[model samples]
Target chain A: MVGPVFTWIAEHPKVFWTAAQQHLVLSAAALGLALALALPLAVVLLRWRRAAATAIALVNVLRTIPSLALLVVMLPILGTGFQPALVALTLYGLPAILINAYTALSEVDADIVEAATGQGLSRAQIVRRIQVPLALPVIFAGIRTAAVQIVSAATLAAFIGGGGLGELITAGMGTLDIPQLVVGGLAVAALAILTELAFGLAERRLNRTRHA
Target chain B: MNWTLANYDRLFTALAEHVGLVATALAISLAIALPLGVVSARRPWAYAGVMAVTGVLYTIPALALFALLIPFMGLGTAPAVTALVLYSLLILVRNVATGLREIPHEILEAADGMGYGAWRRLVRIELPLALPVIVAGIRITVVTQISVATVAAYISAGGLGDIIFQGITQDFGEKVVAGAVVTAALAVVADESLRVLERRLRAAQSERA
Candidate 1:
């Protein structure tokens, strides 16, 4: 099964590469959109104590919706292909990122925040220079989780006619093409591991830089 | 779009089925994870290998994993349970290992010095001390499993996902929202309950200490 996949990859390098690009694009777009929305949502939710529970509840609801179902739900409003897939994936990613971000920011040492305030650091400066840096590791972990999840969920994009390696797996399933299925599965698995390692390294580097 | 008692009853039944599947899967995962975690903790090399294997398993996408297993297991409860169990292992094992490792070294040394056997130390000392973290991991695993298990509906393992999947096929917003609402409620209930359990376990551990 693996042999045929390698042979096919060798013969059609461009096709495999193109699929990989599409997969990355989908994952990246979803994750990027999620981070952009979730960070501010986290900040605002944290600041407004009364709104925190409601915000968390909304995210919880969004997160629990099955990704495929969410995609389908979006299809009616957004139409199919990448747009609906991206919307669903972003919605899926937001809860984790938001919760982690909120936790990380709120968990910042109150004394340190107070000290910064005492030094006449503006609220924005304190948030940017102290809270954000202090919260980076946890926020990054959330991003890592979101990244892995988005990458994997992007495979389902094919079900909505959004092109990616999912197309291969879905097609292979229909025809019982073991090589295609295995390749698609293995490729996604490998990509996930690579993403984990890359993020893990980046996390370590950031921690080191922070300490230094 | 008119609300009906039949639809309400069907929704409740689906919610019950989904909860049942999640509970069954979590119980099985805990049963396996607790023992394996303890044994692996005692053996460093085995612990590393087990963590690596489970970690790798965790990265496999839920959809792909389910699709891959369909041929061997056929699409139904069996495959769904198997996949959920595999998914739980990474979190459970890692948490168990961390909890075990975090036990003060001096305490273990004292247990050995007092001539406590390996099994006695593990049973009477390490396991109790590690229970809190283990429960925390289980909480996370259970919450995650509840959310993901909805995907099993795709393979004909009936649950709240049935509503969502049906809604998808029929383009019915109400059905989709119904399923989503139930699942979210389930997640919150499971999470809060486990959190309570985790706190109780921690309190007990502290009392024991």
Candidate 2:
């Protein structure tokens, strides 16, 4: 099994590289889009307590939808390829970041905010200097979770012509090439683990900074 | 609507298979995770080890895991259930351990004062208190597995995912909608129902207190 995997990798270096690159790009783009959308919305939602709770509940429900179904659901609307895949992945990634952001922001210490205000910090300045910094670690944690999940889900992009490591697995399955499938599976697993670890480390560093 | 109505029998069969697959996987996962969780609960080193291993397992993508198992398990419910079971262990074990570990020490001491043996205490005291958390874990596991099981269809595990995939491949929008809608509904229903159960158990525990 090991020898065959190595042989397959050696034989198809370009294909393997392209798939890995696509996987990384798809996961990264989705996380970026989700963060961009979720963070600001979370902040705005903070001003409306009822809306925040309702939105979070809605997101929780949405999160129950499987990643595959979410991805395929996009197919009818966007008609396949990277555009649909990214949109689906972004939606799939949103709930974690949004929920975490809302919780993190709202949970910022009230007394501390008052103290910052007492220091004559303007509302914008307080948010920029205090609230965001305090919320950064939790938001980062949300990012880590979304990143890992998106990387895993992005493999399904191959099914709809989104071109990722999943393509190899599908092709290998079609051809009954066990080694090829294993290689693709291993690559995807490696990417997911790497994303998780990288974010874990970054989150720790963010914590250290916040504490300091 | 027309497409779903026309394919009602097929849809129902697929739904049954999907539910059966998830149920079987959850049962096996709970059986294994419960004992492991109990043993690991009191021992920090053991808990750490169990979590480290299961965390890695959980991090692997469902599709990739399924693909990896296809060769060894030969493309059917066996491999799919195996993947789902592996995916579930981390959540179930963690919840069980946390639930057990979080029981107030005074409560355990009180149980001890009542001459409750270790086995009896665990059976009567610890597990009942931990019920809510364990059920919460099961709820999450069930919802997540329901979603993941759809992808199992790719490997001949047969579920609503088959319809979604078929729709995508065949350019049939209605099948995709039908599959996606039903799958989402199943997940939401499972999550909401379990949440209610968890809440009730928590309320009952507090009432006992």
- Measured by lDDT, the strongest candidate is 2
B67: Cα error in model 2, Å: 1.3
User: What lDDT tens digits, residue by residue, belong to model 2 across residues A129-164?
Assistant: 998888888888998999998999999999889999
At residue B117, candidate 1 shows an lDDT of: 100
| TM-score of each model, paired residue for residue | 0.84, 0.98
Per-candidate alpha-carbon RMSD to the true structure: 3.4, 1.1
lDDT of 2 by residue, B128-147 (tens): 99999999999999998998
Residue B182 in model 2: lDDT: 88
Q: Who wins the TM-score comparison?
A: 2
lDDT of 1 by residue, B79-122 (tens): 99898899999899888988998999999999999999998998
Q: lDDT at B103 for candidate 1?
A: 96
Number of the top candidate by DockQ?
2
